[model samples]
Target: MASSLTKDSATPAPEKTFLGHPIGLATLFMTEMWERFSYYGMRALLVLYLVSGGADAATGSQGGGLGYTAAISTAIYSVYVALVYLMAMPGGWFGDRVWGARKTVAIAGSVIMVGHVALALPGQISFFVGLLLVAAGSGLLKANISTMVGHLYKGVDDPRRDSGFTLFYIGINVGAFAAPLVIGTIGETVNWHIGFLLAAVGMGIGLLVFLLAGRTLDPKSSQVPNPLTPAERKAVIVKGLAVAAVVAVFYTAVTMAGMFTIKWALYPITIAGLIIPVAVLVRIKRDKDLTPGEQGKMSAYIWFFVAAAVFWMIYDQGGSTLSLFGDKNSERSLFGWEVPTVIFQSLNPLFVVALAPIFATVWVLLARRNREPSTIVKFSVALAIVGASFFVFAIPLSQTAGNDTKVTMWWLVLIFLMHTVAELCLSPVGLSVTTKMAPQKYSSQMMGVWFLAVTAGDCITGLLGLAEVKMNGVGVILFQAAAAALAGLAIYMYRKKVDALVEGTK
Candidate 1:
C-alpha cells in the first residue's frame, strides 16, 4: 500500500481559498481545533483528579480521585506529556513512510477517542490504560496535522505562510480555551468520568470533520513521501520490538528489586527526553545527501529547538504547577461563587485567541516593510518576555508566603497574558521556520523532530515539580525565570551567527 502511494505525483495547490489562503486550511483548522478540545479538556482535569481524595463524608461530596501526592501526580503528568510529544517521531515516520499524513491522522484520532472512553470507565487500571492510549494517540496526531498545514502553502517563502500558521494556531487555542470552560467545569463540579466522555465526543467530531472534508486537502498529502522497502520495514519492526523488550525487562527488574516507584520509573523517560534530540541532531548532520544550506539551516534549527524547549518548560506549567497554585493559593471568589481552579486553565488559550490575529497582521505588515524580525530574534524576545512573567509572579508569591492570605486570581491572569504574547513571538514562527528548514525527503520527520523540544521541556517541568515540593514556590519560579532569561540573552548574543546559518530562510 505504501509503495503504491509513493508513485503518485505531488498535487497542485487548490484554487479555492478560505479567507484568502488555501481551502484545505479550513478543513485542517476545524479538525485540529476539535482534536485540541479533546486533549486540553482531559489535561485540565488530570493532575487535580489524581490528587483528589474520594467522597468527603462530612460534606457528603463525592470525588473519585487517585489520592496521589503532588509529587507523584506531577511526575506522572510530566511523563505523560513528554511521551505524548516523543511519540511524534514515530507518528511522523508513519505518515511519511507508511500511511501518509491524512490516513495517519484519521487512525490517530480514533485511537484518542477510544483512550478517552477508557478514561471514562471505572477502575484504577482503566485510568492508567486510558492515559497511555491518549498519549500515544496525541503523539501520532500532533506533528502530522501541523505538517498538513505546512502543505497548504506554496513553499517556505510564501508570503501567506506565517499568517496561515498563526491563524491555524488560533484554531488550536480556540479549542484549548473552550475545553477548560466546558470540560473543566464538568470534571471539577460534577462527575470526572462524564468529563472524560465529553472529551471523547470532541475527538469524534474532529474525526468526522476530517473524514468528511479531507478531500479538499492537497492530494499529495495523502501520498507517502518516502515509502520504505520490504527489507527496511522488517528491520524497523525488529528494532522496535527489541527496544520494547529491553525496556520491559529493565522495568520488571526494577519492580522486583522494590525500586520501581512512580517517581523513580520516570527517570528513564526524562533521560530519553534529553538524549533523543542530541541523537536526532547527529543523525541529521550525518545525512550525506543534505546540501550545505540544509545542513546550515539544521544547525540554526538546533538553537531554536533548545530555546523552544525552555519556553514550553515554563509555559506548560499551566496544567500542573499553576493549576495547583490556583487551587491552593489563589482567591477564587466571584460574586459569592467560588470558581473552579481548572477554569483558570482557559486563560492562556483565551489570550492566544484574542492576540493571534493582531500578531499575524503585524507580521504581515512588517514583512511588507521588509522590517520583520528574524526567527532567532523573535525567539530571543519571547524567551525574555516569558521569563519576565515568572519574575512578576514571584513578586506576588513572595508577599503571600508564610501566611494564610491568598493572592488574587488576577495575578494568574496577568501571567497568562504575558505568556500569550511570548507564544505569539515564538510558536507560530517556530512552525513556519521548521517547514522552511526541512529537507524535502525528511519533511514530516523533521516536524516530529521539532516537537521533541516540547518533549524535553515537559520532562524538565516534571523534574522541577519534584524540586518544587522541597523548595518554596518563589524560589523555583525565580530559578526558572533566571534560566529562561539567561537562555534568551545567550541566544541574543549569537543571533547573527544563527541568522547566517538560516541562510535567508526568513
Candidate 2:
C-alpha cells in the first residue's frame, strides 16, 4: 500500500528531499514561520500594551488600555493564549475529518490575516472581533501544519525526522527573532495599529506561499486522514465553524469580564470550562481497545500536561513577568542607548537559534551512546532550570532595595539564557511526545489538549504575577521558583514508571 503512492519502490525507500530533505518540509516551515511571527510579534506587545496603557499621540488616547488593573490584564492575556491552543482540537478535527491539511491551512491563514487587519482598527468592537478571528484561525493552522510536516516522513523511524523537526523549529525561532524588533519598533515608535498591520502583512506572505506550493501535499500520505465526503465535509465545516464561533463568544464574555468587576462570574466560568475537558480525558482512559502501555502513556501525558502548564507559567514570563521586571527593575541602557523592553523579548529566540544546533548534536551523540535521558528526565531538568532562573530575578530584588540604582542588565540576560536552555529540553520535546504517544485517530485533538496546559498555565501565571504585586517581590520570585522545582520533583519521583510508559518512543 505504501509503495503504491511512491514513485520508487525497488528497495522500498521512503520519500526524499528535493535537495537533501523532503520538499514538503520547507513549505511547512515557511508557512509556520510567518504564522508564528504574527503570533509572537503580537505577544511581544500584548502585556505591555495592556499594562502601559496604549495611549500615544496617534492613538490619541490616555491610559492606553481597557482600564483594567494589572492582574485582570494578565488573566485576560493568559486565557487568550490558552484558548488559541485549546481551539486547535477542533481545528485539527476539521483538517483531519473535513478539509484535509492543505485547505485547512489556507483558510486559517486567510482568516488570521483578516484578524490582524481588524486589530489595526480602533475600538473595543474591533479588538474583540480581531481576537475571535485570531483564535479561530490559529486553531485551524496550529495542529494542521505540524501534521503536514509529519507527512514529509514516510515512516516514524526516518533518520531525518528529528533533524527535519529541528530545522522546522528553527523557522519558528527565526520568525520570533524578527517579530519583536520589527513590530515592537513600529508599535513603540509610531503606532500600535501599525504593528498589527505588519503582522497582517506577514500572514499575507505566508498565505501566498502556501497557496502557491500547496500541491506538494498531493497523493497525500495516510498520515493525513482522507477528505470527508462532499456533503459530510460541508456539514462538518459549517457546524464546526459555528460551534467555534459560539465558543469564541463565550470566551470573550468570560475573559473580558474583569476579575474585580465580576470575580464571581469569571471564576466559575473558567473552572467549568477547564473541568469539562479534564472530565472527557478521564472518560477516554476507560476505553477498552487501548493497550495498557498506551493507557499508561496517556496517564503520563496528563502529568506532562500539568508539567507543561507549570513550565509555561514560568517560561512564558518572557512576555509578562519578565517584560515588566525589565521595564522597572533592570538597567536597559546598552552603551548609553536605552532600548525598548519589547526588544528584550527577542533574546530567548535569538539564544535558541545560536544554541539549538549545538544541542541537537549533543542529543544525537547521547542517543548513539544509549545514554540519552528519558523524556521525563529531560522534562525534570527543564523544570528545575526554569525554576532556578527566578533566582536571577531575586538577586535584583535584594540588591536594588533603598535606592533608584538599577540592577545590572546581565541578570536579565542570564535568566533568559537559562530559560531558553530549559525550553530546549521541554517545549519542542513535549510537542514531539504528543505526536508520538497520541493514538493515530486522536493526534490533532490530543495535540490541542497538550496546548490546553499552556492556556491553563497562562491563567495561573497571571495569578502568580498578581500575587507578586501584592506580596513581597523576593518572596514572589521564590514562590515561582518553588513551584517550578516542585513540578520537576514530581516528575523525577515518577521517573521509573514514566520511563516505562514512554520507552521505545518519545
lDDT of 1 by residue, 169-276 (tens): 779989998999998889888989999999999999999999999888988789999899999999999999999999899889988998876666577777888789
CA shift at 381, candidate 1, in angstroms? Answer: 1.3
- Model 2 residue 432 CA deviation in Å: 3.6
Residue pairs that clash (backbone atoms under 3 angstroms), model 2: 17-21, 53-64, 54-64, 55-64, 82-455
Give stretches of model 1 more than 4 Å off. Answer: 1-27, 54-62, 149-167, 212-221, 286-292, 365-371, 439-443, 466-472
Model 2 lDDT-worst window of ten: 54-63
* Model 2 misplaced regions, further than 4 Å: 1-19, 54-67, 153-161, 219-269, 398-405, 439-444, 462-472, 501-506
- Per-candidate local distance difference test: 0.86, 0.76
